[model samples]
Target chain A: MKLAHIQQILQAEVLTGAGSLDREVGMAFSADLISDILVMCKEHTLLLTGMTHIQIVKTAEICDLAAVVFVRGKRPGPEAIALAAQNDIPLLLSSLTMYESAGLLYCAGLPGISRNPDPCGRAKGERTG
Target chain B: MSEQAKPEQILILEFTLKSLDFMRAGEASSEFKQRLKKLGFKPELVRRAAIAAYEAEMNVIIHARKGVMRFEIAPARLLIVVEDEGPGISDIEQAMQEGFTTASAAIRELGFGAGMGLPNIKRCADAMDIQSIPGQGTRLQIIINNE
Candidate 1:
């Protein structure tokens, strides 16, 4: 899905990368934990996170994420916005909850990245029975 | 013509990390990633190396008093060695376990301290080695093959 489409769907404000709205993103991953993103995120996936720190931008850069949408009405400070602009990472802010944002995107034909929660490949609550 | 085989060339990069320096934490690994890209490693290889290196570097920035990250790049592989002066892990085995973290609530607010750093690094690298003294410090080495 194009980022412009995502912005409109969630009613998010583009903090930066206004020029990048036309870029296409195929997958989306929502997480508040940076480590979860680090360990599980696929390259070029769009990131929907509530954390408004600069590390989110750094994680996106390291993982080559498509863009970051801050859910729950979170707003990153100037420094975070500056770094994202410097790194060419688009930052968006939305009033929707993480669940709502993710649901809207999923319903709009954007698929979420899937991963086994455990590295061992066992389902989180699977029973042998 | 020289009969001896040519010695393999290695590129080296060194970086200093300070604890709680959240603003500049990932700069070193970002540079390493860019360098690898400029040298033309495959994107998958570059991403793996960058993720491993960034996690290692963040470990230092999150827990150490100070540390150094050294990168050794060869045609076949990339080796990253991070040495830090901090409260070293008393149990390497436990520290390597996923979801076992010592990070404080403040660190968690920054979206870290999930105890997945070492395990994630291991997942990204082909080989990993760690040595630490409870009070003295810790040293970590990670190698990601170009293949």
Candidate 2:
């Protein structure tokens, strides 16, 4: 999907890099954890998160992410926006919550980046389950 | 190899990773990327160098008390050396496990700590060498081929 398409679909505001809207996105991952993103995100993946930190932008840069969608109406601070702009990373703000935003994107054929199922079936937060 | 034939520009960055400075953690990596870009590295090589350097910088900040990152850039390759004085890993094998992490909740909240730092360094570097003592510190040497 292109950033323009995503902006239209989610009714998002493009905070920066409006010219790069036509960039291709091959996958999507909705998480705030940088490590999980590093491991799971593919090049050109659209990242959905509520966190408004500079690290998110840095993560996108490192992973070569296509765009970042700030779910739950979250707005990044000026410094964060500047960093995103500096990196040519398209930033979007949406009022939709994480689940709804992810669902909408998934329904539109943007699937989550799948990981190998953990044999232990341990959830994200459980320690030693 | 003649010293005169080697690339002339070498950039070195030294910073103190104050414990728990989440906001400033990835700053060095970002700078490293800029340096690589100025050096006119290939896109693929630049990406690998950025990932390895960024991950290593983050590790020093998240896991160690303090550290320094030195970048040696040449026409053929980039050498990155990161040294951190932290509670060294007792079990290197366990630390290498893909999903294992000792990062705290604060660190995880910032989107790191999925235990991929070391793995990322290994993945992005053409060669990686790690030396750590249980109580001393950890030193990581990574080289990314520029050709």
Best by lDDT: 1
Instruction: Judge candidate 1 at residue A67 and give its lDDT.
Output: 96
Minimum summed lDDT over a 10-residue window in model 1 chain A is located at A115-124
Per-prediction share of native contacts kept? 0.85, 0.64
C-alpha lDDT of residue B146 in model 1: 78
lDDT of candidate 1 over B52-145, digit per residue (tens): 9999999999999999898988889899999999999999999999999999999988889899999999999999999999988999999998
Question: What TM-score, over all chains together, does every model reach?
Answer: 0.91, 0.83
Weakest lDDT window of 10 consecutive positions for candidate 2 chain B: B1-10
lDDT of 2: 0.81
Interface RMSD in angstroms for candidate 2: 1.8
Per-residue lDDT value at B34 in model 1 = 89
After superposing candidate 2 on the true structure, give the runs of residues whose Cα lies further than 4 Å from its correct spot: A22-26, A109-129, B1-14
Q: What DockQ do you compute for every candidate structure?
A: 0.72, 0.46
